[model samples]
Target: MNNRTGAIESVAGNSNFAVNSALSFGYRWFDPERWGHWSFDLDFFGSYMGVGVSGFGMSDHENLGFLGMRGRVGYRVWHDRLEPFIGMIGGSVLANTASGGVDHGAVWGYWFSPTGGVRYYIPNTRWSISLDGFFRFIGGVNGLSGPGVTINEAPHAGLGGRWLYEPVGIVALGYRF
Candidate 1:
């Protein structure tokens, strides 16, 4: 009887350990709890032409460039295997073009982008991938003139939505801490 009781206790202990380990890993990955509901995300991304013309229709505008730093603060709206989130982001786009022996200089613009997305947590694991899209309202391109040129000389302030990429998409890896 004594030996049987000891064996039962040992099995129970091992089962508890396995359960705890699984729970810890899940929390680290999914982070479904509401106690620490705030999350910060950092991402690097590139954009393709959602709109606009390039090079007199010779080619699509080269939209490949550093997308700059993007930071977002999100509250966990719903937490499950797939977590859906809403957040706000701000970043800049620096674009340069060279054509016909002349470097067209750089255009810098700031944007206020509101984002929403969902993260799919892998089954029984702490690894997850997310897809996010943002509608970016960019402004403040007030004084963009080409090299060796003046605003009056260019005859345009370069303001307005000179570049367009609606619903920018991003994929990211994240872990719960």
Candidate 2:
């Protein structure tokens, strides 16, 4: 339940938000029956983005992406009309980057992320809303160009900015069965 992580495209003229487009897919498994308001979860998420690049070899653009899986423990309060939950997620993170086109070669690494989020569930319905965020700590790598920022940053580098450890935010719609 969140926005995809990657470089944000900045396009000229109309279609302003198009520059910020990202493709993301995720799956989550949860226990519907809470054990004393606590639940267990298994989650998987992935994202990809490519944008036009300039001043980098003869490459047309840069591509970056990541895939991750995490286990979570959560606690819910007020299980009736409005349910609020808080959870912590931890897992392995894999990221890869292709800069200055595919010919420049791609660099990748394994990393891990610790995340927490709050979710609101509406009663009598299977739909829910969530806002989650996490920090990406690249394994032993430091410093990356925009494309390298994600996995090295693990899909947390959305813009052309420098960061030691990158942060990501996710606001997405979810369904519970």
Candidate 3:
């Protein structure tokens, strides 16, 4: 069983509450009936993330948004009943915040993610459930974090993770058309 727990992000001793989520639309690229056991898909995705910090009687809140596209390759091993897939996602994110009555405009950064998941179609319905996991690889703290270089970058090799894993994954219910 896979699980995920939400937590705050810590950077250079500064920590803030961060919430991450995504919404996507996808289309199968190849004719499933003709492909026989393998399928390809293209997806357009968007994500939302909120970060908040409070200390010294001052509070700063931020809303981060992301948009991207993904390409997926999947294989059906059990009569189209069970499928396992992997995909690549590329996108950009906007980080906007307000601090002590001052507003900072949105900052942008590019990112790439490699994801894997398993899907199971319910008995005889078009509805399916999937458990997906991915590790986002941010190029660098290019914008969003101010002019200063990012103190902590992606591919963290800390005790907790090298790449963001479970408890950080997404589960979705989808319909095949």
lDDT of each: 0.47, 0.51, 0.68
Q: Which portions of model 3 miss their true places by more than 4 Å?
A: 1-17, 29-33, 97-104, 140-168
Clashing pairs in 3: 3-167, 4-167
lDDT of 2 by residue, 12-103 (tens): 22111112222334454445564556656666666554455444243344444556666666676775333334444433333333443443
After superposition, candidate 2 runs with Cα above 4 Å error: 1-34, 49-62, 80-104, 140-164
Model 3: worst 10 consecutive residues (lDDT sum): 1-10
TM-scores for all candidates?
A: 0.49, 0.55, 0.69
Error of 2 at 92 (Å): 6.5
lDDT digits (tens) for residues 9-78 of candidate 1: 2111111110000000112222437546665565554443322233432322223233434555555544
Question: What range of 10 consecutive residues in model 2 has the weakest lDDT sum?
Answer: 12-21
Candidate 2 Cα deviation (angstroms), residue 80: 4.8
Q: Against the true structure, whose TM-score is highest?
A: 3
**Candidates' RMSD to native:** 24.8, 9.5, 8.3
Better of 2 and 3 by lDDT: 3
Top candidate when judged by lDDT against the true structure: 3
